[model samples]
Target: MHTTTPTVIITGASSGIGLAIAETFLAQGYNVVGNARNAARLEQTLAALNCGERFLAVAGDIAEPNTARQLVTHAVQRFGRIDVLVNNAGVFIAKPFIEYDQGDIAQLIATNLMGTVNASQAVAAQMIKQGSGRIVNVTASIALQPLQRVPSAIPILIKGGLNQLTRALALELAPHNIQVNAVAPGLIDTPMHTPETHEFLCGLQPAGRIGRPQEIADAVLHLSQAGFTSGAILPVDGGMSSGVW
Candidate 1:
């Protein structure tokens, strides 16, 4: 019988939704390995959580395939098996398509696209060997429903691909008993958003308020345990994707 607890690797885990997800999993007794580009910061924050030996911080550039390999290697070495991989690392930039610069485009592709791809590839191999696992992505709801005021085609373009990747990977990995899913969120009240923008952000959602990081964390937790569910993009978007507000 399997005696050890499940292990989860959460990318971009130093802050925002990623941090919340880490906290949630830790609270539930899952061994957590968190990744981020900032090593000191990642260690400082998560280590302070007093998770003892159960929490590990592997700091590296999320955009690199090496980083994803490092995460998988560390998780397997420390925890013995990988059960969940949360591709929660991403960058969202909003501006007119024409206004986007090369740097912006490159960063978006690196953080939002390649990070997920690399992490998924590395983790899937391990999970397939183990015969079971879960992969949950944190994509954006804006990819589905566009906002004229927020002409962020570049971010949507990459995030849109993730939504598709969720389905594609789910189909490809089903026989291995590995489920792939995504949580597409609307405006969330993270450190990414300043306090002054909260009121304005509230109006953008049918719920009349931005979502909390913990809310997204909750959605991810659900996907992590949902064995019968796959290829599903669960929108925790406060009705933004529901219809016209």
Candidate 2:
């Protein structure tokens, strides 16, 4: 590892695409601070990764601004400074719009929308102080190109806003030498998708198969290092953002 390699804070890093991002960054020798709501799960994840001192698991709800602030403090205190933040914490509720109850709507907003906002807002301030950083959000490609078979209006409504926000944040932070980008992924093979739904989920996209979490992780890593690439929402979903299937 270099003497001053990047230190990254990856929210929702206990599983799925977030986990992959954590592992990818650690493997590349970046100091990683992984956050999740469940403390026990985060401990298990830290133990399982066996990444030694390079990885730090900080448990917290990304939806809460206090948690976001704590994550930044832990990362900075442990690694000296923060270089990248992956706002990968989110929740997806897939059902008919009318079927969504108050709880469902609230959960979706708190996790998917507010979670990103909280983390990004807190991290952006730190980055501004440091004079450089990268913010990569894990959005959804299906939000831009909704599947008729999957009617998740509220979730899409939240993610679509994130897509636009990525652009807006990129422009806002560009002068500070901070890049904000996003990777909009399609259906991926993760614990989030059970085995039974794999086949059906595959058919929703033109890829004819599910994407791997590593693909999304790779996209995030690219954006983290791509100095000139800001505000661009790269689609990692196999043609899902192209058009209607």
- The number of clashing residue pairs in each candidate reads 0, 0
36: Cα error in model 2, Å? 0.2
- What TM-score, to 2 decimals, does candidate 2 have? 0.97
- 198 Cα displacement, candidate 1 (Å): 1.0
lDDT of each: 0.93, 0.91
Worst 10 residues of 1 by lDDT: 1-10
Tens-digit lDDT string for candidate 2 (1-245): 32387899999999999999999999898999999999999999999999888888889888888999999888888888899999998888889888999999999999999999999999999999989999999999987788888899999999999999999999999999999999999999989889999988888778899999999999999999996899898999989889986
Per-residue CA lDDT of candidate 1, range 70-101, in tens? 99888888889999999999888899899999
Best by lDDT: 1
TM-score of each: 0.98, 0.97
Off by over 4 Å in 2: 1-3
Task: Give candidate 1 misplaced runs (Cα > 4 Å).
Answer: 1-3
Candidate 2 lDDT (Cα, whole model)? 0.91
In Å, residue 101's CA in model 2 sits off its true spot by: 0.9
